[model samples]
Target chain A: MTERSGTVVGPRPPTVIVDDLHVVYRVRGAGRTKEVKGGATAALARMISPRRLAGERRVHAVKGVGFVARRGETIGLIGSNGSGKSTLLRAIAGLLPAESGAVYSDGQPALLGVNAALMNDLSGERNVVLGCLAMGLSPREVRERYDEIVEFSGINDKGDFISLPMRAYSSGMAARLRFAIASAVNHDVLMIDEALATGDRAFRKRSEARIRELRAEAGTVFLVSHSLTSIRDTCARTLWLENGELVMDGPTDEVVRAYEDSAGRRSSAP
Target chain B: MSRDVIPRHGALDPEVGAAELAARYGLGVSGARPSPVEYTRRLWGRRHFIAAFARARGDGQYSRAHLGRLWQVMTPLLNAAVYYLIFGLLIGTRDGVPDFIPFLVTGVFVFAFTQSSVLSGVRAVSGNLGLVRALHFPRAVLPVALTLAQLRQMLVSMAVLVVIVLLAGQVPTWSWLLVVPVLLAQSVFNAGLALVAARLGSAVSDLAQLLPFVLRTWMYASGVMYSIGNLTADAPLPVRVLLDLNPAAVYIDLTRFALIDSFTAAQLPPYAWGVAVAWAFVLGVGGFGYFWQAEGRYGRD
Candidate 1:
C-alpha cells in the first residue's frame, strides 16, 4: 500500500480517497487451466479444483494503488495501454468493484470514456435528452438544457446532423456530443478517460476550458489521456501506473518526466 | 484555486492518514451497491429515462423495415394467420368453442407478449453492455424497458384484435372493460419474467441461445393453439390443474374470458382472476428482487 502523495494540505477537504484499491477481472477463453501431477490425477483434480470457475483467467487489472484527491484538484493518469489507467478511472467512478481495499467518495463519480456511447442508434438530439435524464436530471431540466447540450457540442454548425442518429455522425462528432452531454451537469467527481482525444484542436481547447471551469465547480476531476501534452497541460497531479501498479504519483511534470525517462531507458536498453 | 500547487509524496502531516481524512470528510465506498430500498428509490428517479428508452428502442427496432411501423401490426397478424390455418382449418382443434378464431388469435397475441418479454429479457443486460458500463442507472431499467417495449407492441396488436373481435360479431358490453385489468396484470407479470430472465442471462451466456426453444415448448403446453380442456381432457386432475394454473395459460384465459363470449367464466378454473392476480404479484416482486441482488455485477465480462 502506498502512502498519501499530496502535500497540498489546506481547508480544501478531501473529495475522493482511494485506499489500496485492487480490481481483478475474471475473463474467459484462451487461458490454460492449472497443471496437475498426472493425466488421470489432473482430470480428477479438475473436478475437485477449488477454483469456482474452471479455466477462467484472472486478470489483476489494478493492483494496490492508493491516493486521496481533494476538492478542486485535477489528477491525470498516464500509463501504457495495459497498465490499469482506464481500470483505475473506472474503479474510482464506481463502475468496477474493488477485489480488495476501497474507493471512498463524497458522491458518485461520473465517468466519461471513449468506447461507451450513450445510445449509438438514437439521434444525437434524443441522446442528449436521454443522457441528461440518465444522469438524474428532471424532465423539465432536460428540456431547459436541451439546446445548451446541442449548441455546446457544435455538431449542427456544419449541417443538420443533430437530428440524425449517432451512428451516422463521424466518431469525432459523437465524442464531442458525448462530452457535451456529460459535462452539461456538474458532477461531484468527474473522471475522463481519453474521451476528449478524438475532437479537433479547437474543440479540445474549448473542452479544456470547460474542464478548467469545472475544476472550481466540482469536488475533483480525474483525467487519463495518452496525449502527454494534454496531461501536462490539464492536470496538476499525475499518477503513473505500470503493469497494474502505480509507479509514481506526484506533480504532473515530475511524474510525466519520470515515466518518459523509464520508457526511453527501456527502448535504449534493447 | 491555485492550480498544480500540490507538493511531494509522504506529506500527509504524519498524524492524519488518507482513510482518516476521508472518514472526516464523510465519504463512503463509491462502488458499494445500494440497499434494496435505496436501489428502489434510485430506480424511481430514473423512471423518465426508462420510459423514454423503452419508447425509443421499441419504435426504432422496426425503423429499417420497408413497411416501417406497420410491421409491428403485421408480424403478429401474420403469426395469427399461420396459427389459424394450422389449428382452426387443418388440425380442427377448436373443440366446439364458439368464436374459435377470436379465441385462437387472442391466445397468440397475448402469449406473444410474454414470449417477447422473456426473449428480450434474456439479452437485456448483457446486450446493452455499452449503456450498462457507460452510465449508472438501475440495471433493472434495461429489462423493464425491454418488457415495456413489448407491452407497447402488444397494445398496438390489441387494437387490431379489437377490430377482429368486432368483425366476428361479438357485441360490446361491460365485460369488454376487463381487457384493461387483464393487460395490466399481464404486463406486470411479463416485466417480472423479464427481470428474472435478465438476471439469469447476464450470468449464463448460453441462456440466450436456449430460451427460444424453451419458450416455444412453453407456448405449446400453455394451450395457445387449442383449449386446454380439449387437449388435457383425458389427463388426471392434478395434471389438468397444473396446466390450468400455468402463468402463461392463466393470462391467455383471462383475456379470452373477457373478449370471447364462448370462452365464458364457467369454462375457466375456480377463482380465475384471483389466480391471475397472484401470478402477477409473485413474479413481479420476486423477479425484481432476484435481479436486484446482482445489480452491481451486470456489466462484468
Candidate 2:
C-alpha cells in the first residue's frame, strides 16, 4: 500500500473503505405517459411531440452511507425490503455503478447472489467447472478440487444428480451449488446476498462455519440477509439500514435489537 | 454489548478524495475501468473459460433436437439445397459460372458463418444478462465466446461442404490449401463484427429486429449467388472499386477462387489478399478496443 497524506488511522488497516457511496437506479419506462384523445390529429400531434411516450423514474437505492471493513471481519447488513441492502452489496462488488461517492476494496470482491447464473441446461458437473472458471480459477485447479466441490454442494447426496442437468435440481439445490462454487476460492472479499437463506439448516451451519474459516484466513465477508438469526450467529458487527439511510452500525446484538424494536413498533402501530 | 462504544458515522476525514484513501489502503475503486493492457491480460488469462463456454454453448444448441449434433451439418446442407433449387435450377444463376453447385455452396456456407455469428453476437450480452449480472469477468467474453461457438458450428458445417464439393466434380488442387487461411481471416472478421454487434445490441435492442434484414441485403450485394464481376462490370470506376473491396465479397471470392475451377486469379480484384488482411486487422483490433471502452457499463441498469 502506498502511503497517502491525510489518511485516517484505524484500530487495524482497512481492507474495504466505502466513502459516502450513493447508488441510484434510473428505471426507464417506469412512469405512465398521459393518454392522448383518439383522433388522427391527436395521433399526429403525439408523434410530433418532443415529450417521450414513457417517463423515467429514479430510485435512490443507497444514500451517502460510509463504512470501513478490516480483514478477518464479518459484517452483516440488515434492512427492510426495498431498503437498499442488496444494492450496496452490489456496489461494493463492482456489479453496479455508484451514483455518487465510491467503494474501495483491497481485492476483487466475489458476490454470490441467490440467483447465480449457473446454466440450467448444463449438468451440475459442467456448471461447477464453468462457475469455477468464471471465477478465474485455472482448469487444473478446478479439476483438482472437483470432487470436493461436488461434496460441498451436496447435490449428489440423493443420487447421481450431479450428472443430471441443473434444471432438474430445486432452487435450494442450485443455490447451494452456487454457494459451494463461490466459496471454493479463498476470495479477498466475499459478499453473499441471501444465498444462505435457501439452504437447509445443516447447509446453513456448514456455510456459516466455512465463512468463519474464510474470515480466519484474512478475508472480509459481507452478508445481507432477512434472517436476523443467521446474522446474529455469523456477524459480530451489523449495519442497520432503513429507506436507503444507515440508521445504526455497531455491535451485532445492539443493531439487531434496535432494528427489530423499530419493526415491531411499526407493525403494531399499523 | 458495550454501551460506551460509539459507532463511527462517516468518520473518514473529508479532505481526502476516495482515490487517495484507496491508494493508502491498497484498495481499488469498485467499477473502475482497468487499463487496456491490464484488461487484455486478464482476458488472456481467461482463455480456458472462453473455450469451455464456447464448447458448451455449441453443444447445447442442439440438445433439444432429436437429431442432436447432426443438425450442425444438416443446417448448411439444407440451406444449400434451397438455394441450389431456387437459384441453380429455377432461376439459372449457374449459366455462365462453371461448377456452380460448389461455388454456390461455398458462398452460402461462408456468408452464413459471418451472418450467424453477428446475429448471435447481438444477443450475446443482452441474452446473457443473468451470467453478466451474477459474475465478474470481462463482459467481452460473452461476445467472443458466442463467436467461437459459431465458428465451431461453421467448422462442422464446413466438413459437409467439403464432401458436397468433392461430389460435385470439384477436385482437390494446390489452391485448396488457401481455404484454411481464408477461413481464418473470415473468422477474425466475424469475431470483430460480433463484438461491435454485441455492444450495439445491448444498447439498442432494435438492432436485433433489424439485423436479419440488414444481413439479407448485405448477402444479396456480396455476389453470393453470382460473380461480383457481373454486377460491377458496367458501373463507374469508384463503384467497381467499392464492390471489389467489400470485405464479405472479398472473403467469398477468396473461397470461390480456392474451391471452384471457374474462379481464377484473373477474376480477382487487384490486391485481394491485402484488402482481406487489412479488413481483418482494422475490424478485429479496432472492435476489441471499442468494446473494451464499455467494459464497466455492460450489466448495469
Candidate 3:
C-alpha cells in the first residue's frame, strides 16, 4: 500500500466526494419470548437469533447517495425525520459505516451535533481547551486561540466558574461554550447537525456570521437541519433527502420552495 | 485549523478499492475512500493528538480536586497500606513469603494499574461517545491514551515501592532491571485487554460494571493477594493450567521474584518470562485487531 502524501486544501479542491454510499444499521434481537427450560433457553435463543442463523437484517439508512462538496461550498442538507439526512451527514463525516460506497475528503472533518456536550464536570472555560484538543488542534494553537474562543463564547465574567467545571453551567451556557470551541477554528470540512437550533436568537445570529466567515475562508460546511429558514439564509446549495435517497440537489431557493410547497400541501390536505 | 496537515492533492485514487482499505483499517465499511496507507499514516500523523489527549485526560481528573493531583499518589499509597495490613500483618503471610511487603506491594500496585487499564478500557471508547460521534480521528487513541496514563501512575507508584523495599532492608539486585521489560510486557498485555474490553463495553454497558468485579476476581486468581502456585499445587492439572493462563500471574510473580533477588534460580523457570512476553504480544496485537475490526461502528449509539 503506497502512502498518500498530505496536501493542503484550497478553493479548487473537492473537500468531500461521496459516491454510491449505502448505510445500514443492524441491531441484535433482545428479550427472547420463546419458552424453554432454564439452561436450554440461552442455547436455544442464541441458535435461533437471526444474527446467528442468517445474520442480522440491515435497516437501510442511506442508499445510493452521491454528492461532492468542493472548497468554498456551503451545502445544507434538509429533510424530515428518518429521511437519512443525519445518516448521510454521519457517513460523510466518517462516523457511520457504509455498506458499499466511498467518501473521500480533502482534509480532517469535524462533526458538530446538538448532543456534543462538553465535559460538564469541568468548568465552561476549561471545556474550551478540551474541545480544541479533541478537534485535533495542537497545544500551541490552543494557547494562541484560547482568548478568542472565550471572547466568542461571550461568557466572560463567569471566570473561575468557567475554570470550575462544566456541570455548574446551564445547558444553554454549555452549548454556547461548546459552539465557540468548535467554531473557533475554520475547518476544511465542518458538518453541523441542528446545533444551531437551541441557542437564543442573538447567539444564532452570531453563529451564522461565524459560519459565513468560515465559508469566506474557502472552507466547506455541511449543515443538517429541519429549519428551512436557517438553510435558506446560510447555504448556497440545498440537498433534499427522503427515505434514504436524494430527492433533489440544487440552489437553496429552488429546493426550499419545492419542499415548502410539498409540506404545505400535505398539511392542508389533512 | 492547521492548513499544513491538509493534503494538497487530487481526489482519492480510483484504481484502488478505498472501501476495502477503510474496512480493513476500521473506517466506515461503505463509502470509505481512505487510501491504502491511510490507516498507518493516520495513526503516525496523529501522534500529537494522542499525546494531547492523554495529557488532557491525565490532568482533567486532577484539575477539580481540592487535594489537586495528590490523590494520584495518595490513592495508591492507601491501597498498598491496606493490602499490607490485611495480607502482611493480619493474615501473617509475611512469614511464609520472602519480602512479604515488597512482593505484596508490587503485586498489589501493579495489579491495580492493570485493573485500572482494563476496567477503564472497556468503557474508554464508549465513555467518549460524544467525541467519537463528533470527531474524525483514530478510534484506538482513546484506549491507548488511557492505558498510557495508567502506566504513568504505575511508574510513580513503582518508585515509591522501591523506596519501601530498601527501607525494609531488602537488598536490590541486577534482576531489578528485569522488572522493566516484564512490566512493559504487562503494560502491553493490559493495553490489549483494554482495547478488547472497550469494544465489548459499548454494546453491553452492563459489561463495564461487571469488568471491575471480574478484575478483582482475577487479582486473587493471579496471586496478587495469595500464592497461586502454593494454593493450586494439589489441584488437578487442568485447573492448575487454568491458573497459569491467568496472564497477570506471570507478571506479578516475576516482579515479586525481582524484588527478593531470587527469581532466576529458585523460582519460575527462565522460559516462563518468554512465554509471558509471547502471550502479551499475541493478545496485544490480537486484541487490537479485534477492536479495530469494529472501528467505524463504535461511534453508533
Candidate 4:
C-alpha cells in the first residue's frame, strides 16, 4: 500500500480526504431528545403533545466541512458546545454516516470521546486488555503493554484501583483509563473529544508526549478541546467550528485568536 | 485515515475529484460495510476476544448477589423447583409422564439457554452502544459473547441436571452422553436467535421490553412442564406433528430421551434428530446472514 506513490519516504502524505461532508442526525421523538434549544417553553411544548409534535427532526450537525489531514499532522478542533465538534469527530470515525458527502480514509479511525466507555461492569485492567484486543492487538502485545497502560492512566497510583470494577471509578479516572488504552497503539487517525480534559498535569504532559510520538510515527491526530492551552501546546493547526460549520482552519494561534475575539464580540454586543 | 499521509498543502480543489484522489492514494470510503467474506475473516480474528469477553461477563453476571457465584447454579435450580410445585404437584403435569422432577428440570434447563440467549441478544447491540461506537471490532461479537455467557450458566445448570436425574432413580447409561451433542445443537439455535434478536433490537430498542413476554409465551407453548405427546395425543395428526416439531419441544424431548430410561423405552418421536439439526442449520446460517446484512448500520444515528 505504501508503494502507491513516490512520497513513501516523505513523512507527510494525505491520509484522510473529507470533501464537502454533511451530517444530519435524524433523531426520533425529537420533541424532547437532544434538542439544541433548551428552555421552559420548549419543554412545555414537548410535554403537552409528544406524539403529535414529535417527528423525525433533522439535526444539521456538520455542514459542507472539507479538509485533508496528512501523516504527521496534529489538528485541533475548537468549537463552543453544540457546535458539531463531537459530531464531526464521530463522522470521521465512521460511527455516523454522511448525509450528503463522504469521508475517505486509508484505515479505521479511532475516536475516543467522553461518552464512550468500554465496559463499566468490568475492572479497569480488563478494560485495558479488552480495549487493546478490540483494536486488533495480539494477546502477547496487550500483556506486554498492560503495566505501562495502567501506570500511564495513573488510576492505581493512589490505590489498587485497577482491580476495582469500572463502575466504582470516578468520571475522571474512567476518562484517564480510556485515554491510556486508546493511546497504547498508534492509530492512523486518532480523534480525542474532550477526553483529555480529565487528567491531572502530570498525566496531561504524558499524553501530550504520546501525541507527539504518534505524529512522529506518521499518524494523524485530531483533538477537540475547550482548553486553549492544550490546543496551543499540542497542535500546530486548529479548525474553528461554529454552529455546525467550519469557520476557520489555520494555525493554532491564528484560529484561537480569531475564536476568542469573536466570543468577546458576541458577549460585548449584548 | 491512511498513514502514508500525502497532502502537505492539505487543501482539496473545489473541482478536482476527491474520490479519485483518495483512491489513487489507496484510501477506502469510511463507513462502508465490509464484504461478507471479509466480515467473516475479521470476526474470526477476534475469536479470543470474544471468548475472554464472554467469560468476563459470565463471571460478573452474579456478582451483585449475596451468594455471588453460587447464584449461577442456584437461580435456575430454584426456578425448576417452583415449576415442579405449580406444574408438577398442583396441576399434575406429571400424570402419565415418568420421572416428573427430572423431566421438568431438564425442560427448564434446556429452555433456559434459548430464553436467556434471546433476552441478552436483544440488548447485545443496543445496550453496548458505547463499546459499539468506540471500537471498530465486529458488532456480532456482543451477541455471540452474550450467548456464550448464557451457555456458561447453562453448563452449570446441566451439571445439576445429571445429579437430579440420578437422584430421581434414573440410572445413567451411555445414552446420557448424548446431552453434549444435544446441547451443542441447541447452542447453535440459540446463537442464531440471538443474532436475529440483536438486529431487531438495534433497530427498535422497545423489542427488549416485549421479548420477555414473548419468550414466556414460547416457553409455555414448548411444554416445559407437561408432556407434549400425552397432551396432544387426542389432537389431530397435523397439530400433533406440528407441536412435536416445535424446535424447543424437540430439543427438550431429545434431552429427556438421553437421560430417562422410560423416555427411551417408550416409542420415540420419528426424525427428532433430523428436525432438531435442521432447525439449528436454518437459524444458525440464516440468522448470521440476516444480521450480517446490517453490519455497518449498528449503533449509527
How far is A208's C-alpha from truth in model 4 (Å)? 0.8
Q: Number of clashing residue pairs in every model?
A: 0, 0, 17, 6
lDDT of 2 by residue, B21-45 (tens): 5776679887778988999898888
In terms of TM-score, how similar is model 3 to the real structure? 0.79
Each candidate's lDDT (Cα)?
A: 0.84, 0.83, 0.73, 0.86
In the order shown, the candidates' DockQ scores are 0.40, 0.41, 0.21, 0.53
Question: lDDT of candidate 4?
Answer: 0.86
Best-fitting candidate, scored by TM-score: 4
By TM-score, the better pick of 2 and 3 is 2
User: lDDT tens string, model 4, A91-197?
Assistant: 88888889888999879998998878888888998899989988888899999999999999999999899999999999989999999999998899999998989
Cα RMSDs of all predictions? 5.7, 5.8, 8.3, 3.5
The best candidate by lDDT is 4
TM-score of each: 0.92, 0.92, 0.79, 0.94
lDDT of 2 by residue, A145-221 (tens): 99998998888888999988888899999999999988999999999999989999889988999999999998999
Model 1 chain B is weakest, by summed lDDT over 10 consecutive residues, at B1-10
Interface RMSD of each: 5.7, 5.1, 8.8, 4.6
Give the poorly placed runs of model 4, Cα more than 4 Å off: A1-11, A30-54, B1-9, B265-267
Docking class of 3: incorrect
**At residue B159, what lDDT does model 2 achieve?**
84
